[model samples]
Target: MEFALAALFELFESLDQCAPGSRAATLQALQACEGLAPGARIVDFGCGPGPATVALAQAGYAVTAVDRHGPFIETVRRRAAAAGVGDRVTAIVGDMRAPDFADGAFDAVWSEGAAYSVGVPAALAAWRRLLAPAGWLVLSELCWREGARSAEAAAFWQREYPDMGDVTQLEARCAAAGYAVRGGFWLPADAWAAYYGPLEAAVPAVRARHPQAEAQAALDDIGREIALWRRFGGEFGYRFVVAQRG
Candidate 1:
């Protein structure tokens, strides 16, 4: 289990790209939110390498992109600068389960699939405290209903997000967290196909180039996970969320 997760992390961190294109989806979701204006203060809970961060900054929002990894933070900062939005963006190294921001300091917060690495419920509970009045929160999480948990699926996610719950339960939990669940959209399946498919196919070359590295192994593991999803993705639900603080 630990090996799979470590491999998965290595694969993701090494990629110049990430999917389920949560970055693009989060940007689209945030566009539908209110009170996001020029200079609106926002924080990304687990922003990796600055896709949504770059987008948010490009859209004229004052953005703080946070991730626990120093390399990711540096990547985001460098990318933001190259994109010419560096002055408007801030990249920090911090974890979601224990973020390093002040209470009621941000008007918005964002999270991608990175929330699953920690625990979503705990992250939601902790970070909701940092939001200002009526602040917005956007999430792109992978989930499956409790009843839909097959032995195979359970085994698959047991190492992924063992704490994952269904979409309805997520709605209820967010509601209880003083939030108003606005809406959710199923992520574009074609995007997933495009990303994961090539990633799987890249294994051989990646293996040949760095046989001892975890990247190849992790990509293979994810490919297996994708194959499992192809078989039973119908039983699970993942999406983009827009929620407002109550």
Candidate 2:
């Protein structure tokens, strides 16, 4: 598990942005938040590289993009500047589990592919305090589609993320945590490709640089992850869950 995390972080840090999908997906996630008012103040929690942060700024929101990695925060600052949204974006280095912000500090809190790092239920509860009344909470989480589970896919995720749940379960959890689910949709297949394709392409070169047995093990683990998605993608995927503080 440590190697898996190290490999994942290494890959993301090497790139300009860490999360998956295109600019369109980012926009779509933002749009899905019915409670997010235009020109709102937002906290992009666990924002890696600020792809979504720049997108949110471009969409007219003032965003504070927070990530624990300094490089990721630097990337956000650079990208935001290049996009001419520097004034609207502030990149901060901090833990997602304990964001350094005052109570009711933001109109919305957005995270993509990062909430799971802190556990969804805990994230929903903790981050809710950062949002104003009726503020939006937009997050993309890995969830199983309703119905029978594919043995291969289920087994893979059991090892990868044992706490993962289905959409119905997530909605109930949100309600229990004092939020209302506005709407949500599963991320399209292209989203997975966007992240994996680049990582897959980089492996050969990266592998050559790492001839050590430990490095090989990490590479193998990453390879298996991509392969599982390729084979059993339909069995599970990310859901762009948009909720509002109640």
Candidate 3:
């Protein structure tokens, strides 16, 4: 298990960007939320390489970017510095399953394509306690678009993440978790293009560098994921959910 996780992080590091959507998409999500005042303190869980973290920092929020991978944490630090938001961004190496912070430590918790690391339902339940009254939580989760299905896509997601659900279920989960559903939107095709387009283009180079079985499997898995997206993208997408602690 450790070896596989290491190989996964290795693959992640090779890519320039790890998550979907651009800074603009992140800003748009933030803008749609209320209670996220200027200079709000935000905790970015599983913030690989700090794309959204830096963007939030640039938007005048003080961000705490957390990821377990050391290299990704370093990348976040470097990127934050390059973006000149180092003062507002603090990169920390920590496990998302066990965030080390006091209760009500942040005004908002932002996660992009990373909430699945701790399971969406559990993440929603646990992280809600970390927020102050009326605090916001924003996450981008892979969601099943109701009534859209392909055997290939269904099989892939079932193998990769069996706990995935549709937007309505997620909204219900939010309400049950004591949060008011603030609204969310499906990430546009351009967002997937931004993440997978570069990744697909780099697969050959990445595969050639790592010839081990584990590495090859990782590469093939990524390719399969990209292919599945291309074939059944209309059936599902990354949904950005914004909810506030009530």
Candidate 4:
């Protein structure tokens, strides 16, 4: 498990993004978060490599970017500095599931394509206390799209994310977790391409470096994930949800 995790971390460490997202999509979600003026306090959970963190800081928010990985947190700090938003961004190596901030400390909580690390329901429930009254919670989660699903895709997600559900079910989860459903949108196919393109290009070099069985298994898992998206993408996608603390 340690060898596999090391291989996974090495493979993903240099990518500009750790997930399927774009600056455009991040800004779009920001726009959906009404009433937050410039310099609003925002906390980014599971902020791998700080793509969204820098974007939010660029948009004039004071952002606290949190991730468990030390290297990724350092990358966030470097990116924020390079982007000229270092003063506005605070990068920390910490668990998203149990951030150490005081209750009601933020105007918004942002996470892009990383909420699944802890189940979305648990995330929604746990993170709600960090938001100020009526503060926004924005996140993108992998979810089943409406209509037919291929057996292969179904099996893949069932094994990988057994708690996965449709958008409506997700919305219900938000409400159940004490948030008011604001709105959501589907991430485009190019979003996936953006994340996978560099990842696919980097795989061969990583495989060559880490020639152990566990490392190879990790690489194979990533390959299979990418291939599954190519074959059955329409059945599942990342849904960006904007909910306000109720």
* Clash totals, every prediction: 0, 0, 0, 0
The lDDT per prediction is 0.76, 0.84, 0.86, 0.93
- Which runs in model 3 stand beyond 4 Å of their true positions? 1-7
| Inter-residue clash pairs, candidate 3 | none
User: Candidate 3's C-alpha lDDT?
Assistant: 0.86
TM-score of each candidate?
0.85, 0.93, 0.95, 0.98
lDDT of 3 by residue, 1-246 (tens): 444455566667866569787887899989987758879899999899788998999999999999988899999899889988899998999988878898999999899999898888788888888898899989998899989588888889899999889999888888988889888999999989999987887777767766778777877888888888888889998899988898
Off-target runs (Cα >4 Å) in candidate 1 are 1-10, 22-24, 145-151, 209-219
- lDDT for each residue of candidate 1 in 1-246, tens digit (9 for 90 to 100): 555455555555665446566456656787778767778898987788767788888888899988887878888888899999999998888777888788988989887677777777787888898999889988877877446567888888887767777788788878987889988877777756655776676555555655544555665666788898798777776667789988
Model 3 error, position 22 (Å): 1.7
Q: In model 1, how large is the Cα lDDT of residue 145?
A: 42
Best prediction by lDDT: 4
Summarize candidate 4's per-residue lDDT along 59-127 as a digit string, tens digits.
999999999999999999999999999999999998888879999999999999888898887888889
Q: Which of 1 and 4 is the better model by TM-score?
A: 4
Q: After superposition, how far is residue 137 of candidate 3 from its true place, in Å?
A: 0.8
Off by over 4 Å in 4: none
Q: On residues 1-246, what C-alpha lDDT tens digit does candidate 2 reach at each position? A: 665455556766776555555677778878877757668999998888887899899999999999888888988998999999999998899987877789999999899889899899888888988989998888888889877788888888999899999999988888998889998887888877888888888777767766667777888888898998888877888888888899
